[model samples]
Target chain A: MKISILRKKLDDKEISAVELTRLYLDRISAADKLTDAYLYVNYDGAIKAAQSAQTIIDAKQSRPFTGIPIALKDNLCTFDMPTTCSSKMLDGFVPPYDATVVAKLRGQGAVFLGKLNMDEFAMGASTKTSYYKKTKNPYDLTRVPGGSSGGSAAAVSVGLCAAALGSDTGGSIRQPASFCGITGHRPTYGFVSRSGCIAFASSLDQIGPLADTADDCAALLTATAGRDIYDQTTADKTFDLKKSDKGIKGKRFGLIKELMGKEVDKDVSAAVKKAAEWFINAGAVVEEVSLPMLTHAVPIYYLISSAEAASNLAKFDGVRYGFRPEKTLNFFDMISKSRDEGFGWEVKRRIMLGSYALCSGYYDDYYKRAIKLCGIIKSQYAEAFKKYDALLSPVAPTTAYPFDKLPDDPAQMYLADICTVSAALAGLPSLSTPCGYDKDGMPIGLMITGKRFDDAAVLSAAGAYEKEFVRKPPQLKGVSEMKL
Target chain B: MKSDISIKWLGNLSKIKFDDDGLKKMAADMQSIMTLMDSLLLVEPVEFEDGTEFCGLDALRADTVRDSFDPELLVSQAKDSKDGCFVIPKIL
Candidate 1:
């Protein structure tokens, strides 16, 4: 059920918070092995929170999220539950405090559905890079749920949870949501605070929501967004939860030319074209928008994200916190061996590339150039915004590739985010709304990106499309099949 | 082209030791990524705009006395700690 309907049910006392929490927990226990959606299940803590929510409900004083259960991406710090980032580097490390988003959600009396799995430190396009279990696509168990927010989207897809929060840097949330056939929203950068979430690439990373619908995503974004004194990057502007649909009447949307190349899968391109046609039918102008600088987005994003990651990850040297090698050695040697063992191959690869980029003699040639290219990329998006209210694209080139179809080279996998990175580079509000299915029946997501800090407009615009064109995915199996 | 020697230097800088096979894979991967990165060479010079006043570095809070995590809680995350200090290997 959607968040509003579920809230109404709780308000009417049709079901208690305890009963709802138990239902979700039971579903998670049943299918978590197949989906690998959760890294840790906070059953005891969820029950406690539900009981507290029930007290508030009985007294007739309840918030919008009072009895709601949310699956949080494991990267966010939670005082009680483990925030592993699905990496062995910080295995079993629980923070002393909650991330600002966690604190805000707790204040709303939201029940914890435990820490969901993600790419180790939110690094890759696929959960194959996770140090823990590989999450499977709910649409097809043989395929991967896209990462780094694979489990978060998959959980919401299969109805393991009502909504989930995931961090997106270069399309983690949107990519996974596309694969899993759910709605995921990456809000304007700096609109949502990032304090206490484990850092991957500081400037690029923004925590976002994955849910069953656009309105659910908007509600979750409302709960987590707003200013935080702890994270100075946050804007003080409040998120307007009230959605207004102008419909596609007089709405001008650009079909990003670069994103709809022949390289994109046939059915994926067809879905994007169909979305454009729907807008045209609604009396809106649709034009092919060219942003030549988008080609550079992938490389620039990789360089910048990895460079930031190297510096951010330097803290995990085994002395301060988390997993440490038991072998006796000097301080430096201990740190070296611990990291070598602790981090996965992908993490180590990025760290090395980042180190090389920032190292002497190559700093200007690599890191600085990448930053300059990022500025150019942003300028292209800014120019496009002058003509269009929003831009459209397929979330990825194709739907979820089979799990066994692993690429040996890391660069081969980086190609997956080709369509989704440009918006992230510009700090825009981007979302993936499931539009249609591919020939293989895998879901295709229509990506909509609006101006920076125009999150409400972006969300409502996409939500309007859902109302107009009811292109729903096939019925999911497992828990989602269970009639709630 | 990414040199094997330079990558070895990079591994040293990153403080992660690689076996011979690991070194080969890292070198090949870095080389491929760098080749892909050449696409950025076409873009002209550009400036990184500092964000708005409320969201930039200048908006950071003033340095002042503030509450921090309890020392016990801070040390609790350390795998080995004693007497308010993390226990690392010998330095001197």
Candidate 2:
């Protein structure tokens, strides 16, 4: 069920918040077995929070997310729950404080359903890297839900939660949402505070929402976005998310030529093109525009993101709040052994790659060169934005693939992130909305990106498209929409 | 390229060790990823104009004293702690 309808029913007292929470809890208990979407389910805490929400509603002091059940990507710290980042490195470690977004939602009386899973330290394109469990796409139990926000997408896709908070470094939220046939938004860089989010690629990581609709995502962002003194990178800006005012008349959209080219699957390209035709018919001008630097996005993203990740992840030395080796020689040996045992293969691969890029001799050749190319991609995006209101493209080259598909070459998986990383590199607002499905009935995502800080407009464009396109929920056996 | 970008060297730098089997797997994985990294060679070495301004010291907030997490609360999260301090291996 959508948050808007739930809000009305909750206000009318037809169904209590506690009842709603129980319904979702029951659904998760039934469905999450196959999806493996949640890392932890705070059953007692959710019920306790819902009782408080009922009290607030009775007194007529309900906040925007009052009584609403929502889940969080495991990276976001919740003082009451473990913030593992789906890695054993921080297993059983509960943060002392809530993340900025979590604090905001708690203040709004949002009931925390639980923490969802993700790629270990947000490293891989699929949640297969998670140390706990690999989240399956709700649409097909065998296929992966793209990561590192795979659990967030899967949970929201199957209605395990009303919505979920996810962090996007390199298409983590968007790609997974695309694979799961849900709406996800990666707010412009610095738009959302990342104070308590476990650092992945600090520069590119921005927490956003995955929900059933673009308007629902906007509601979550409206509550969480703003400057926090703790995170100085958060922009001193705000967005007016007027759900009723979202319209596409007289706007311009650029169909990114490189994203819809021969390299993309025919079914995926067809869906995106059909979305363009929809925009054109709805009084919006659509054109094919080229941004050649986009070809360099995947490599540039890997180099820059990994370099930053190497620096950001240096604090996990096993002495403080995470796993420790059973036996060790000394201080260095202890730290190394703990990290080796704690982290998974993907995390180690990224750390090695990142350390290589940042090494003394290779810094200028790899890291600095990638930064310069990143600047070029930013300029190309700025030029394109001058001619268009928003850009449209496929979220990924194809739909979600089966597990163990990239066993030999992990680079093949990273290369597929080309369609979404340019927006992250440029700090632009981008979202993935379900456009259509492939021949195999797998969902395809149409990504809509706009200029930095033009997040409201980007969402409005997606909302406009969503009004015409009816999203199909996963037909998995246990998945059922709430009758309320 | 595999020899030049040694997995052993990278493992040492990253403070990660691998057994023989792990080393073999890592080498094969790194080689495949390095092939992707080679695409970086195609990019021209031109310095594109970036409009980022240095937000020097002024960007920082005022250093006003505020409440911090209690020492006991902070230390309680440590894997091993005693007397409000984290317990680590003694350094020589």
TM-score of chain A of each: 0.98, 0.99
Q: Chain B TM-score for each model?
A: 0.75, 0.80
The sequence of per-residue lDDT tens digits that candidate 1 reaches over residues A179-256 is 998899999999889998899999888998998889999888888888788888888777765744455579788999
Instruction: Name the TM-score of candidate 1.
Output: 0.97
- Cα RMSD to the true fold for all candidates: 1.8, 1.6
Report the C-alpha lDDT of model 2 over A1-484, residue by residue, as the tens digit: 7899999889889999999999999999999999999999999999999999999999988888999999999999999999999989999999999999999999989999999999999988789899999899989999999999999999999999999999999999999999999999999888889999999898899999999999899999899988788888887766678843557899989999988778899999999999999999999999999999998899899988988888787788888778888789998998888888998998888888889889988888889889889899988888898899899999999899999675557788788999999999998889999999999889999999997778888889888889889877789885667676
The top-ranked prediction according to DockQ is: 2
lDDT for each of the candidates? Answer: 0.86, 0.90
List pairs with backbone clashes in candidate 2: none
Q: Least accurate stretch of 10 residues (summed lDDT) in model 2 chain A?
A: A237-246
Task: Report how far off residue B33 is in candidate 1 (Å).
Answer: 1.8
Specify the poorest-scoring 10-residue window by lDDT in model 1 chain A.
Answer: A471-480
lDDT of 1 by residue, B1-92 (tens): 54544766788799887788888888888888777766666666567563422254457777899888778779988988998888887898
The per-residue C-alpha lDDT of model 1 at residue B74 equals 92
Listed for every candidate in order, the interface RMSD values in angstroms are 2.4, 2.1
The candidate that wins on lDDT is 2
